[model samples]
Target: MVPSDGTAGRPLRESIRDKLRERIIEGTYGPGDRIVERDVAADFGVSRLPVREALRMLDTEGFVEMLATRGVIVKKLSRRDVLELFDVREALEGLAFRRAAERLTKRDATHLGALRSKARKALEAADGPALHGFNEEFHDTVNRLARNDLLASILEPLEGRLHWIFRQNDRPDQLWREHEELLAAIVDRDGDRAADLAVAHVRVNRDRVLSHLFGDHPEGTAAAG
Candidate 1:
C-alpha cells in the first residue's frame, strides 16, 4: 500500500495508482465502466497528468483497457481468467509452502505463530479488516520464507485477485482454522503435508468461491455487493 503523501510534500503518484487499482480489483469501477482521467484527477484532488500516469500503470498491470473511443475502462476477468489465475496460484503456492517447510528457521516459525495468533484474534473479533490484513501477511511471510523472490513476485498479483474472493465466502473461523492447520504443517517441517495443505486450502476456497459465484447460492451472495 502506497502512502498518499510522499517525502517531497506532494501526493505520490504510486499512492493514487494503488488506490485506483484497488477500486478496480474490488469492482468499485466494474467491468466496462469508463474511467475518465480528468474525473479521477478531480476525485483525487490531483492533476490530470498524474491520473494519466496512474491509468497507464494500471493498464500495464492488466487492470484496465485503453479503448479506442472510450479511453479507459475497467478490465473484466472472465471465468476462464479466474480459473487460470487460481490454477497457477494453487501450484505456485504449493511449491512455496513445501520449500518453506524444508527451510523454516525457529525465527520463521515464531513469526508465523504470531501471525496465526493475530489472525485468530481477528476472527474472534469478527474484524474484517484485521482478518484480511493478517491473512495477507501470513501468506506473504510464507512466500518470503520460501526464499524465492521470483515465486513471490508471481504470486503477488494473483494474491490480490484472490483476496476479495476469499473475503466473500470465507467464514472468519474457518479461515483461522485453515491458517493454523497450514502453519502446523509448516512448523513441523512436514514438507509434503505443508504442500498438500496449501493446495487443499486454496482449492477448497476456489471451489467455494466458484460455487458462490455461479452455483446454488442466492444471487449476489458471495462478494460485497
Candidate 2:
C-alpha cells in the first residue's frame, strides 16, 4: 500500500525508502520477508534505480539484509538482539527522562498530558494502531523535551525496533498505564523518580516481549535459575 506518486518535493529514492520502511514497521513487510525490487518499483511507479538505491539505504540502516543469492529481506532480530536493544534503551531513555524533568516547561507538560489522555482513550477503545501512534508521540515528545540531538539520533532507530516489538506483543494497556506514570513524574519535575520509572518501564516492556517470545520462562529468568 505504498504511495505511488505523492512525493513532490522530496527525492524519489528517499521517498521510496520511507515508504518501504513504513510498510516494514506497520507489519506489511515482516521479518525475513523478501523485498522484491521489481515489485516495489512497479508498486511505486518508479524506476528500478531509485528502488535499488532506497533498498541500499534501508540495508545500511539495518532494517533489511541484502544478499547476493537470496536478495533483500527484512532483518530479523534475535532474542539476544532484542534484550541488548532493551538494555541500551533503558540507559538512554532513563537519562532522557531525567534531563527532561529538569527542564520540563508548562507547555511541554500540557502536551504530554494531552498525549497521555489520547493514548488512554485509544486503549479504552481497543484501537491498537491509534494507541501505538499516540504512544510514539508521547515518547517522541519526551525525547524532544530532553533537547539533545545526539541522544535523539541514537534513540530513534532503537525506537523503531521497539515499536515493531510492541506491535507484536498486543498488550497496550500496561504500556499506556506506564506512560501515565511517566508523565506524572515528568510533570512533577522529579528527575530521580522520572529516571527510575523510565528505566523500570523499559525493563517491564523487555520482560513482556521476552516472556511472549520464550513462553512462561523468559530467557533472563531461565538463565538465572
Candidate 3:
C-alpha cells in the first residue's frame, strides 16, 4: 500500500491507483473486467473524482483501456503482447545483469541472498502471489544495482505488466533456481555469464507461459509434432 502523507487529492488519487494496480496484478481484477469509477470510489470510501483520475492514469500506463461502450477495463494480453514483452525484457535486462555484475558489492550480495531466501520460503508454502512479488523484486533490485537511470525508466512502466505476465509461471522453483544461478554469477563478477543467464531465464519463462496459454506448443511453433 502507498502510505499516505496524511494528504488528499493528488496523493489520494495516486494511492487509489496503486491499490487498483495491485488488484489487477494479483488477479483480483482480471483482464477485461470492467472498472466502474463510482464503484471503486464507494469501495475506497472516497469520491468518484479520484477514482476517475486514477483510472485515467492507468489508461495512460497501458494497464487499462477506456472504451466508449464498455467504459474502463483491464487490458487483455495477446500472444503478440506476451512475445513482445519478453523480447524487450531480454534485450534490456541483458544490459542490467552485466552492469550489476560489474558493480556488485557485499551489501548487494547480502540483500539479494535475503530476498532469495524469502522467495524460497514463499515457494515452499505454494504461495503463488507472494512468490510473484518477490520474483519481481529480485529483478528490480538487480536493475537498481546496475545504476542505469534510463534503463530503469524504460522498465519502470513495464514492471507491473511483466508481473502480470509472470504470474502465469508454472515452474516457480525452476525459475527461482535460475535466479539463484544468475545472482551467483553477478556476485562473482562474471558479467558475461550473468547477462547470458538473465536472457535465458526470460526466454524460459516466456516459453512456459506461452505453453500454458496455447497448449502443448507455444506460439504454434512446432513444425513436426
Superposed Cα deviation of residue 35, candidate 1 (Å): 3.4
Candidate 1, 35-123: lDDT as tens digits:
99888877877777778887888888777889898899987655565566667878798999999999999999889888877887788
lDDT of 2 by residue, 65-129 (tens): 99888999999867766777777888899999998999999899888877877887888899988
As a whole number from 0 to 100, the lDDT of residue 187 in candidate 3 is: 86
Q: Estimate the lDDT of model 2.
A: 0.81
Question: Who wins the lDDT comparison?
Answer: 3
Worst lDDT run of 10 residues, candidate 1, spans 216-225
Report the C-alpha displacement of residue 129, candidate 2, in angstroms: 1.6
**Which consecutive 10 residues in model 2 have the weakest lDDT in total?**
216-225
Which regions of candidate 3 fall more than 4 Å away from where they truly are? 1-10, 219-225
Candidate 2 deviation (Cα RMSD): 2.7
Error of 3 at 212 (Å): 1.9
- Higher TM-score: candidate 1 or 3? 3
List model 3 lDDT by residue over 76-162, tens digit each.
Answer: 877777788888988999999999999988999899888988998998898866777787788889989999899999998888788
What is the Å distance of residue 54 in model 3 from its true position?
0.9
lDDT (C-alpha) at residue 82 in model 1? 55
lDDT of each: 0.76, 0.81, 0.84
